[model samples]
Target: MMAMTFSPKFRRVSGAASGESTVRRMALVAGGAAILALGAVGGYRLVAQVEGDRGIAPLANSEDIQVNGIKVDVTAKTGAEARLEGWKLAQKEAWKKLGGPDMPVEAIDAMVSSVVIGQEQVGPRRYIATLGVIFNKARAGQYVGAGGATIRSAPMLVLPVLYSGGVQQVFEVRGPWQRAWAEFQASQSPIDYVRPVGAGGESLILTAGQASRRSRLWWRNVLNQFDAASVLIPYARLERQWPGGPIHGTFTARYGPDNTFLGTFEMDAGSEQELAGMLDKAVQRMDGLYRDALAAGELRPDPTLTTSGQVLDRAFAELRTKLMPKGGAPIEALPQEIVLPSSTPSPVSTAPAETVSVQFASPDAAAVDAALAAVRGVPGVRGAATMSLAVGGTSVMRVTVEGGSERLASALRGQGWKVTSGGGALRITR
Candidate 1:
């Protein structure tokens, strides 16, 4: 009230302050609008992905006995009649392949689950096609002994890796190789395959790069997710002669977390139209390679891939450190007599050591380690190592003992473990 009139400096200062406030208000509004726009775009993309087709559906009847490559040519008065005859012929041929006893067409049809047509051409009075016949294992087990009930290996995870167009992928997209494995019938194979139907997060987890990771922790987590004891990588690389032309594939059978190579083979397809068939046959050959490797003991799971293995390794390291000589030389470099402590007496068993196969239930890595530790604690036991590791099932170990398997069994029984003796192997349970 005392100074009603303001100076020109004061008026100018007031105008500058007003201009700064307006700019700040405008900037805040613009920034918020930009943030809202970005969020809207991000939300739209997420919604679209959630509603999209994320994976391929696996075959519903993978457990059936599949006999592929049954070709039939028949002629009749009508197309329907010829088709019917072709199907019946396929069933008979498939049954023969299974080594089943010959029976009437009606009986064979009763065992047939479904007929898969690979290729077909039906005329008014003729039918010619390449077909596959699927036989129900339950219905046909009496005729074939449950598809030859033989010893099957532990559950092996199948990772079908496809390399095409200079890129390697597994379960990233719906590729032909993935489809072939999904359609494969594992009931007849002696190797138990745990196939994943790459959906949602599975596609993200099982990439081609995952095969190269040697970290035991990572592998253990992945195997536990699928209840698999080991991993089987059926790798295929495709080379196209040109666009829409012939394709050549190089296939390899690899197993274990180390990705050890078992065998490799090459196959050719006439064109893209034949790619699927070639892949299907490649899978069959890959299975054969794995089966042979298992028989040769080359496909056993790596003991180091389990957590217990790491614990054992640490223990061994500490023991070696404690045994190291004052001169910093390893205990192995010392004389044999000097290696054993004076307080510990020498083993008295003069019997020659014999290797024995011991089977036990190993529901987890801890159980496997505990079983090995218990068996090793026996006085006559020289060494014990896991030969076949099945985390959620029966695991087998090869043990070398001084007095033979019976002595080892008796010792295990004294330790409160239930032991079963049969087939030259001892099955132990706690």
Candidate 2:
């Protein structure tokens, strides 16, 4: 290191110079010094740039990666850790969160795999896993799209969103088996709910009037932590052979709530006490169901068994069927979206009485425009609008002829529009 010195050429003249002149000279000196400092900095920067250019060299070699694949070094020891066994537990939770109502735990586990931890070493070591999470996507999509529309839909709740295939790739791509296991454990269904989504608990644990409000409370509690949308449950039919003999049972299950069937479960002596307890549980189950579902002056069951005779004494024919047809239950994979409130009406009429939806083949804008014009000319046809065009979905143009909707459809048919009339209206062929 060396010391630098500066001569006081712009020195304070003190009493010799007037105060104003002295201040002005000091400022000029300071400004000059600043300019010199800036010049020195600029020169240093230029030199640094030149050195950097000279020092720059070709990059070193490294492992290669392919799409949907990445490079990683794996050690045999990390793959066989006992903690990894717990990973399945985490998978179960993730599955439960994913499964929603009464989805089979084993099915979920079987579908979603917790692959072993792997590692890669270039200079440092890392962990990784390839987890496969299989689910019923179509149903899931519906549930995701249609969650939270009705009072019954309160059970539909979705949790645990795995955006990737569990193998997150970054910094040598890794996922910890232990951490994965912890996450699996962290995920849980509404275990506290008597009947979780899809009424899973009732099918597994309760019998008789198990479809009561009390039982549903258990489901409500379990699903309480979850946002209402994530849960997706489906209604199903079961041919159950209990101690009382075979009963063709049917119930609607909220996703992950309780009623998912995982193969067969034996009631043996193992679950007897619990089974007996269900007698009272059944009564408790309906605690608020009847009151909640009742209309003005409608007959309702009391949780305290006040209306047992009324419930049981009902005409045999009437007692059997309530919500759905006998031997015909709504069978669909879960995550069936609770249909959201839609201002946009479906072009295809599902309502049996109000309107008819007819589609016209329109390959392009011109074709669609022509179809619209043709529809306008038809008698009784009030209005025609382009439902969808060019887009892959419902590319057919829809013309909703308004005058006595049914008559309009008939009139369109006479105009040679290929049409199928149903759902309270007609679908003009596209």
* Top-scoring candidate (TM-score): 1
lDDT of 2 by residue, 1-430 (tens): 2233445653544654665576677678778888898999899976553242111111221111101112233333445442343344444444454435555656544444233332222222323433323334343343222345322222233221111232311112111211121122111221211222212221222222222234544543333233121232222232334554433322232333333321212122223223222222222222222223222222221211211122333443243334234565443422346322223322332233223455555556566555655665664343344545663334544443434566666666787777675665455653
The regions of model 2 sitting more than 4 angstroms off are 1-76, 79-90, 96-106, 111-134, 137-353, 363-365, 372-401, 406-430
Which ten-residue region of model 2 has the weakest summed lDDT? Answer: 61-70
Q: Give Cα distance to truth, residue 416, candidate 2, Å.
A: 10
In order, the Cα lDDT scores of the candidates are 0.83, 0.35
TM-score of each: 0.66, 0.23
Off by over 4 Å in 1: 1-51, 60-64, 101-107, 136-149, 307-430
Candidate 1 RMSD to the real structure: 10.7
Q: What is the lDDT of residue 230 in candidate 2?
A: 20
